[model samples]
Target: MSTQPTTDVAPSPPAPSEGGRPSDGLQAGLKNRHLSMIAIGGVIGAGLFVGSGSGIAAAGPAILLSYALVGALVVCVMRMLGEMAAAYPSSGSFSAYADRALGRWAGFSIGWLYWFFWVVVLAVEATAGAKILEGWIPAVPQWGWALIVMLVLTATNLASVASYGEFEFWFAGIKVVAIAAFVVIGLLAVFGVLPGAHSDTAGVANLTAHGGFMPHGPGSVLTGILMVVFSFMGSEIVTLAAGESENPQRAVSKATNSVIWRIAVFYLGSIFIVVSLLPWNSPSIVDDGSYVAALNTIGIPHAGEVMNVIVLTAVLSCLNSGLYTASRMAFSLGERGDAPKAFARTSARGVPRAAILSSVLFGFIAVFFNYKWPDTVFAFLLNSSGAVALFVWLVIAFAQLRMRAMILRDDPSKLVVRMWLFPYLTWATIGMISFVLVYMLTDPDGRQQVILSLLAAAVVVGIALVRDRLRASRPATASAGGVRDSAEGEESLPTGS
Candidate 1:
């Protein structure tokens, strides 16, 4: 989410501002169009294209229930965030809310942990995108393609928010249209309306035919939950993007309010058509990946190549958003004095050049890891960042609980995107996330990953606590004296100051 100024509070220290260098003298260069597309694109991700296969395998046709359950949780979480974001609207989004509602420690922990998660994800997506490109051009090598993709995206992000948004808008538009077309064709095939279609394998019976709806039993549904939850991770990017928006409050409200229908159509709707067009137990699903296999079963020509192109687009889109999110989160941290002030500086177009460069550097390092020590480096990166989704979601829930009370006390009328059932539903969502985390611990496949992720969270939280202690122990003289003013004086102010 984009960052907003603190409301009705004394101005805090100004970290380096974006939009231009300290001497270049420019203002925040983000525009409304950039914000809107970022918000929309945030909700669609590569996971939807790639991860649904694992989910379907785990829960069979009943995977619909898993999506519905997770979708409901996301809607509730986003609504809670929307209410707080509309009132406060900072680029830090939930992290800032955590600071105000919970404590400085909560904000520091969540913000840094989230930033870490996305940077790692940037490497993952770049690798995935590179693998796809390598398939088309065998001579380039996967690691080389990974490096090239990261550099190109980093350049786009460093250019301007508008440039990044424009790129993402087209990327997201392609994925959205592709999914819609898939649903349409699948529905036609299910109803036996496609010209000369001879397959007898289409209809609702596909949901229950092979060993009934819960083929793997109720236990597997929990497994399905694990696969589905990650798909929802990108949806929260809207709140962060909203912070930079011209009308942050409105942007948050619209994005949060619209998320439900988007989930319904893009997620539930697409999966429904897939299952309806082919039996849940069909060999094609596990053999060819879910969506591609479904299309191929219906005799769609070039199904493999077609799906590969769509998946490639989805991967590239994810890589683009990952870079943008990592930079913005770093920028937010710098603004709050939680990170180096250099990260707070922006380019001529309001791009946080330092932060963007920092994230890209990590992405480059990851490409090296992919080439030199794929087993250890990539595995560690994956395991360490596994639980971030739960951590972030929990922060959102806690932030909303306090933000709701603050809104009620100050200006209840501003609660335009309130979560349903308020505190009750909020608590329930927390419980649900907690349950998922616990389930992850018990599942053998997820246990080590969860443990590693928890360790990463612990490390960040420890750093935050140490930082807070150091800040508290400092002599009041340093804070009250001219130390701050001297620092400010050494740096040239942005233009328009």
Candidate 2:
């Protein structure tokens, strides 16, 4: 029996443009290889490099279980997202899907919130990358390095989508190679097979010999979830970037299918080597990062500097993608009449120049806030955007549930990608995400982030509701005129009446 809905609407809504909205000027400049590397490399984050230490400390070797849990959540979410994305590829990605499946309010709220999240990330990654670069060259100030890095990536985005893709390809490629090599070499040392290995403590027995796996207690596994969940933020970026590829559906399908292995190899595989190579409770794991400590255990030369280089690459890759993702979301919102129309316009090379500039403008302001008011204003920005990744996954799951029916009824052939277990897994993903958000309230930092993020979301949702109400009250002629002349650029509203 087919699980798909049988009821059909005659003459369904038109399919959205693929590989960029040609009607409004987003272009198909990304090649297959660009998308391939983005998907492969996107799974590994700078957080995995810098943030995993505390998780290991808290959960002991059971931190691996924490990572595994989050990885499974992301896998389920990606499968749902891929189902919709493969059916109707859009530059707007999940936001667009929300517009179609849920409502304009959903699309508008999530889109702007997503944009806000990445712009904040811009400041975080810029500061991180700048700190590294300044250490390498003491002559250049940290702020100057931040400015230089932002300007370089901004120009790359404004040049063309292809330029962004090419840069990301190499950046992601480096990360992929770095992690793969780390895993293989660390594994070699773990089993005492490496010829030059120095540390006698390197062995698989380290997983249990230190404190019996869950040293602190099983409760710490949930704590580790809070520590590691955000690292998976970039995993969905390839779905958004796919809209600019030569084959959006094909690109999305391929990326979605490969996600499991990518997470398994880059995240779980490397962390396995880390824990197996050294005890999770080792002071070195907490003092230095997990990866750096493991490398040092085996007497790898200058392990600190080597990890620094890799961390810097991850930061740069994140900053580069942050700009691209934020601008593209802005471009998408503009096209749907939710934002200023100038963001919808594109350059001759098919770059959304105004959108790029606007996103970077906010990012620059964020960078300023980071340096000028690190505690109050910058902390607010960071906390407010912290829980947005969870919000995004929730929205994607809901949208997929609604969108699956629409696609099946309208044109089942467009279902190139399908979610496993139909509505069952989809509901399970939603339940897990909700539990995570609620569980966050029990922790101090996580509680602050959730409260601030909710406040931010409420404000956006309020604005959207007011706009919807105002549009509803206006006469048809006036509504049309308002779309044309209003400063908000609410033209050609895509949300169905």
Best by lDDT: 2
Score each candidate by Cα lDDT: 0.76, 0.85
lDDT of 2 at 403: 87
Q: What local lDDT score does residue 397 receive in model 2, on the 0 to 100 scale?
A: 96
Model 2 vs. true fold: TM: 0.93
Cα lDDT of model 1 by residue, 1-497, tens digit: 22433221222333333321121111334466666656666767788877788789889988998989888888888888887777665667788678668877777789888887888888788888888899999999888898788888888887777777788878887888898898888888888898765678888888999888889998877888888888888888877766555566677777887888888888998899888888887777777888988888788889889988998888888888888888877776776667777777665456677888988888777767766787898788878888898889999998888777777776666667778887799999999999999999888767887899989888888988887777668654343333232122111111112
After superposition, candidate 2 runs with Cα above 4 Å error: 1-23, 477-497
Supply every candidate's count of residue pairs whose N, Cα or C atoms clash at under 3 angstroms: 14, 0
Question: 283 in model 1: Cα distance from truth in Å?
Answer: 2.1
Candidate 2 per-residue lDDT over residues 320-407, each given as its tens digit: 9999999989988887778887777666677878889999999999999999999999999999999999999999999999888888
**Lowest summed lDDT over 10 consecutive residues: which window, candidate 1?**
486-495
